[model samples]
Target: MRAASVLEADEGRLPVVASEPQSASGLATRLELLRNTLRPTPHVPLAMEGMNLFAKLEYVNPVGSIKDRAAYWILKRAAERGEIRDETTVIESSSGNFAAALAAFTRLVGLRFIPVIDPNISGAYESFLRRICPTVVKVEKRDDTGGFLKTRLQMVKHLCATTPNAYWTNQYGNLDAVEAHYELTAAEICADFESLDSVFIGVSTAGTIAGVSRRLKERYPKVRIIAVDTEGSVIFGGTPRKRHIPGVGSSIVPQLLSHAKIDDVVSIHESDTVEACRALLRTHGLFVGGSSGTAFAAIKRYASRMAVSNRPTVLFLCADRGTAYLDTVFDPAWATRLE
Candidate 1:
């Protein structure tokens, strides 16, 4: 272990896949569960009565979220680059899940972590991060610019400037996050579903749309990739998604999104997302985080549009627990925003 540390010291940053799990077997189980849940099925019958739909159950992942894959990739890549070390302090600005995932990944690497949080983040998620990581910084939403990455980017800018020996796993711009999905998510889906028709994904940093879409398209040349965004999202709406689902959709067109192969963009209303979230909890008992709801609402719309009995359709579910949105989508007072 000391020799490996010395090798990393000389290497600058480890190449990729550097962080090792404390229990390889446990990580193996987590990976298998992730694959089983996220892995696309060949032709599962549509759960909805009339529509032909098969949703990839990402909400079934252990972390109760889909961003865990990105979290795993980003942290692992940084270690490969030797960007993160035992004495290194990691920092990231997040609304919730990303921060939580970062804390978990850092804990695995035995690194000091400092999560820069926004006021919009859920208290449950914030408290959980505090317990997992050694340091946490709360940045008020005083200058909160709803979705243009204003609040988060600003907080990260501050941390990077002041903190020493700190590494920012800049997920927003990192290609590794997308590659993680390309190598894992996309390939697994294609291997199972040979005749995939269309893929539906919610856009945020647009990595999910970009990576998985590109991979699926490469495999299923005739496949249609529909990128979904909230009505206020900047991807196609050309404005910030000012709503509470801060993690997905943005004011700026994410660089990761490849506009050409992107076939089309679907904009779902905030109200629909709330409804879908409630439905997931009631029917499937999947208490997902907010981003998954956004994707779910979009795919449900797509299913209705096809209105077919056997059209192949796939949707990405971003997470599993509403624990992150207890005060927002789950609370009656706050949910009234949808009403």
Candidate 2:
């Protein structure tokens, strides 16, 4: 009944009672530990005007952020399918969380990892990747979209083709990324909430929202799926512009986005994201990242403007911790300079 023991039990298996039967079925692989070491994040509830709110604290995952779910699952499946071996090098393009998650697990399995990122990668993220991943590729040139995303993917393709034993995780276009969230993240949400009215999720690679929406809509056909994006992001038909926030928006539309299922798409500004992050810390005692704040800000607008049933339950996926954005999102000077 001790707190530490209870937490350990939660980490080791699903949050079931000790009397319930659970088995240690498989050999403890590094990927298994990385993916399964933490329990499903808590759905912390809060009272709101038109609905009940729950923040799914995804930052508590092993490597921080919901990307851990996709990264671990992608690598594990690739290894199982004989696409990757112990000596094989894993290559992927990422701005931050996905690469960091991959670096952590690949280091555990003794595989070389190269994270192809852009020049705009944050200091905190770059330093974290450097400490964990030895070979980090920085793509300096921007593509036709005036964003480095296309350029990064081009580098990934080149590396995968030329490097021996190299495999590209291709997170942006990978169906496995969506599959991972469908099986793990969506399942966790359904397990926690029997009848979810709506879910507010950010779209970057679009895997999380696409996977979760597909699974939930399969069961609860009426569940509302709302996508949270930034002003400059082209995901929801906005014109691409200079966006300073890393986690919230993407210059190019992701292949995994499901346009039909998304009932509403809200775009929040960088200032709104900053305010929401500060407000969350001040009011809810949650120090979350920009993507989370973007979702939060969008949810506020949704709750206020959109007509809805009284007291419906809404969920927000808090993607990562504010600690990762201390140099930017949480810093007044840096945020001011960006503005």
Candidate 3:
């Protein structure tokens, strides 16, 4: 069977481009198109001392998260490799954004998608998945690591083994996930800002940090790559506790993470995430997710420690929008429960 040509797809098709080009002039203001359209997310500047703080609002992607890039890159590569045809089913484990992204993109290419999620999955995200995805596997149990992430992966393994013509993106270890951010997200940041001194990114599957950090290091060797993780996440040599935030932490260490590329590590608490989220909304009018709050907290911590002369242009990667976290991060009552 001849594989689908990426560029010459039918009208109202999916995966038009593997990734959006690194040019602001290429962005379209129109909506009412396919949900899988990959465009340049905005970079909103913020007020801070010493350093110039800029927030990369990745929530504006077609699926309203940065994972749109990663999911598209993986699927595009799968198509290029002849791994996905008209009838292939793609299965993967995710917390939220990645699942929603894959669901949107898979529908574009006429493929089936199943996302194995956990109990901590955001209410908004779950509803989004239900609307777009045909089947969503909810993993209620936790693994020996005391987190549902491993359990979710286990379920994915079983499904892939039993289902014929099933393909697991295995995003936790997928290098393509890293490549997506490197070629697109990082390139956009560099293009938008000619001189950047540091970048703070949240780590979960570690794809974003791994790719972006490597790219920045190659170009600006002195640029600080700070890794922000929640307290419960084991990614940054922390004890595996329970993390409330979905996008910024991990129970299991991701294969894509390169510790050598990171210059600093900041572990944020759930309360800090909440406080930062509220602050962003009140002060900057940026309604972002818990992980974005985590990144904001990390930005303050990094800024406070640096001397005035040492301060530089700092960028924070906001993982997703507050809409997906409305039930918890934005709700006063629900947020109190976590406290």
Candidate 4:
């Protein structure tokens, strides 16, 4: 599809160009439009007994996830550095949200997107990618740790080496992903609250917590930065096991996490993740993704141990909406299996 046609199909939501040129300058203009589309997501108060808790509504982004920030920033920075041209195909290994975000933004600039995913990707995300992306590579083979991440990364490497004009965004180790959250996500949080006592962040590629923790520490040095990981995730030195939650944790420890100054780590089981998600929907009417539920679970765990007098202000990111998880997290059958 032509860039002009794609922009039109967007229903005049993005900035328009009369003629779609495939030049570097043209790509920059399209990147600028993508950047302009990002707005500061709001933080709403979540009622707890003692703590002043708030959840950052990152699911409201253009592609409905916090990954939108990193995906756009990585692509925009790549364009500025002359790493990607109009003919370049953007490739990445993602479970769901990142791939969806990349597919959406790359289509706007007329670039082909190939997402190297695995079976763990949610049905909603897989269907979405199959519809929008030019190619979706699903690696069925699991690696030594019985996880698909290593196998997916291997496929990404193979695709990048074989395909001409292909660029791997490499979200796992990309500092641009860190910078995106540091500059945009954390900056927005800082602007919203003058003082924060604690922040809970979910770990996957580790970009979000790494960037956010560094930035928040610089602003509120005493603020506790808690890294939330799933029970099976190896990101925080846990034993590797099968994890059903798509975006909550990781099998491999992301290099980006090495840059973070984490205060503590909270590992939650998939059952707790499901419970937290259901509770958020039932109590607060917030339908959030698995990772957000994981973070919320960590928040509750942390708060329960706190002294009665310490009713500190806390914030956790609601990474994405729960519509994508209806079949898994919200299903009674699935919840029973987790138990």
Best by lDDT: 4
Error of 1 at 167 (Å): 1.3
TM-score list, all predictions: 0.81, 0.88, 0.87, 0.94
Clashes per candidate (backbone, < 3 Å): 15, 0, 0, 0
Cα deviation in Å at residue 132, candidate 1? 1.8
Question: Model 3 has how many clashing residue pairs?
Answer: 0
Residue 72 miss distance in model 1 (angstroms) = 1.3
Model 3 vs. true fold: TM: 0.87
Q: Which ten residues in a row have the lowest lDDT in candidate 4?
A: 9-18
Which sections of candidate 1 miss by over 4 Å? Answer: 2-46, 142-144, 307-310
How would you encode candidate 2's per-residue C-alpha lDDT over 1-339 as one tens digit per residue? 112121112222222111111122221244566665657888898666788899999998988989988988888777666677655788999989998888877766556789998877778788878766656799999877677888998899899899998988888778888888888999999888878888899889998988898888987788899989998889888988778788778888788885226888899989899989998898999999999999999999888755556677899999999987788888998788764
lDDT per residue (tens digit) for residues 300-320 in model 3: 876766655866888898888
Q: 1 or 3, which is superior by lDDT?
A: 3
Q: Tens-digit lDDT track for model 4 on 315-339?
A: 9999999999999999989888873
Tell me the TM-score of model 1. Answer: 0.81
